[model samples]
Target: MSDDVTQDAVLIFAKRLGEIIATCEVSAVWIDSREPCAWQYIRRDGETIIVTCKTLQYWAVRDAAARNGYRLDVKPDEMDVMPGQQITRGIPHADKLSTLAVTPYLSGNSETIFRSAWGDGSEYPTLRRMLRYASTADDLGRAGVIGKTAQEMYGGPLNSSSKVQRARDTGAKEWRALSASLDTARDELIYRSTRPQKDD
Candidate 1:
């Protein structure tokens, strides 16, 4: 799909997702496409979830956090980006936290709810069902749903193999370098623009 189509899809998805998770305290939803072929959803709780249809394997949630100046505690290889799957990580609004207890819980719980409501299927139907489920579920039922999702995602082999880990490490290094270069270029542009100009 074209960029416009992809962005439109993401926006629509965000709207539906926001509605479904409204009770979960999702205050706002916005998309950032800093990485090509991938869209990152920035949440009000300082968590980020990234989605992409690209074939390349990326640590989507981590990269999104890194791009936004928040470093999550997860290893680079933990979560691989795949279509219809969201990688989520909680980040502090100001700086990295000394401990990761609450952030990970919030991030993991939110991710679980989303995956449960919208299992690997077409978007609209899944979301419609999810909304129905959320609308009727009490707090205890919602917690139960999240618990089931947590068990499923974390129960088995979420870990990458050695080879995959190596590749992820290399990709992370390259991504960091590129990000630093872009930051430098942006800083230079701002400096030049703000400097007092002399007569040519």
Candidate 2:
């Protein structure tokens, strides 16, 4: 068979396997990359099994299993460790662990931003400054600011055209209510500033 045909068959098989696993009551699924590339799926019954890969290390597999609340029956010594593979006792075996050839699919691009900020060593100070500014703002002002910021960040209200409009439509509730109080304070300050002082 040609390489393209083999790849298509593998893709189909993987999709079917994923569907089957999804239907099963699995507690967690862990992709183990230590020693032998493998996958470990722990069912709700606490039964744990490992799928071994010759080219990946299963070094962190134990920890991953524990984190997912699985307790494997086999001990470390029971693993058959070879140059590029590690096999656990009493589990189904595959001829080539074909899944290893599949590329990992990361869900987002946030890692690039995170790595860039970390590499430049600016994230810590930026976060600290933001925290300080937030702490210094008065409760009412802080709430208003945070609400406005969130509105802008998330494209206004979940169901409205804009957050400000949403606030007005909703009777200026919660943080928006503070706007009236602020206006009153400003008017009082202006009146006091313009008034003549009494003779001593």
RMSD of each: 23.4, 25.7
Global lDDT of each candidate = 0.41, 0.41
State which candidate has the highest lDDT: 1
lDDT of 1 at 2: 30
Model 1: per-residue Cα lDDT over 38-65, one tens digit each: 2344456877554333211223333444
Candidate 1 least-lDDT 10 residues: 94-103
lDDT tens digits, residue span 1-200, model 2: 22443444455556545654554343223345322233554445675443333211232343334344434466445334555334333333333323322222121223443343344434243333334446667874545544453354456454344655543344335324334444454445445645899999
**Reference-based TM-score of each model:** 0.22, 0.18
Q: How many steric clashes between backbone atoms does each model show?
A: 0, 11
Highest TM-score against the true fold, candidate? 1
Tell me the TM-score of model 1: 0.22
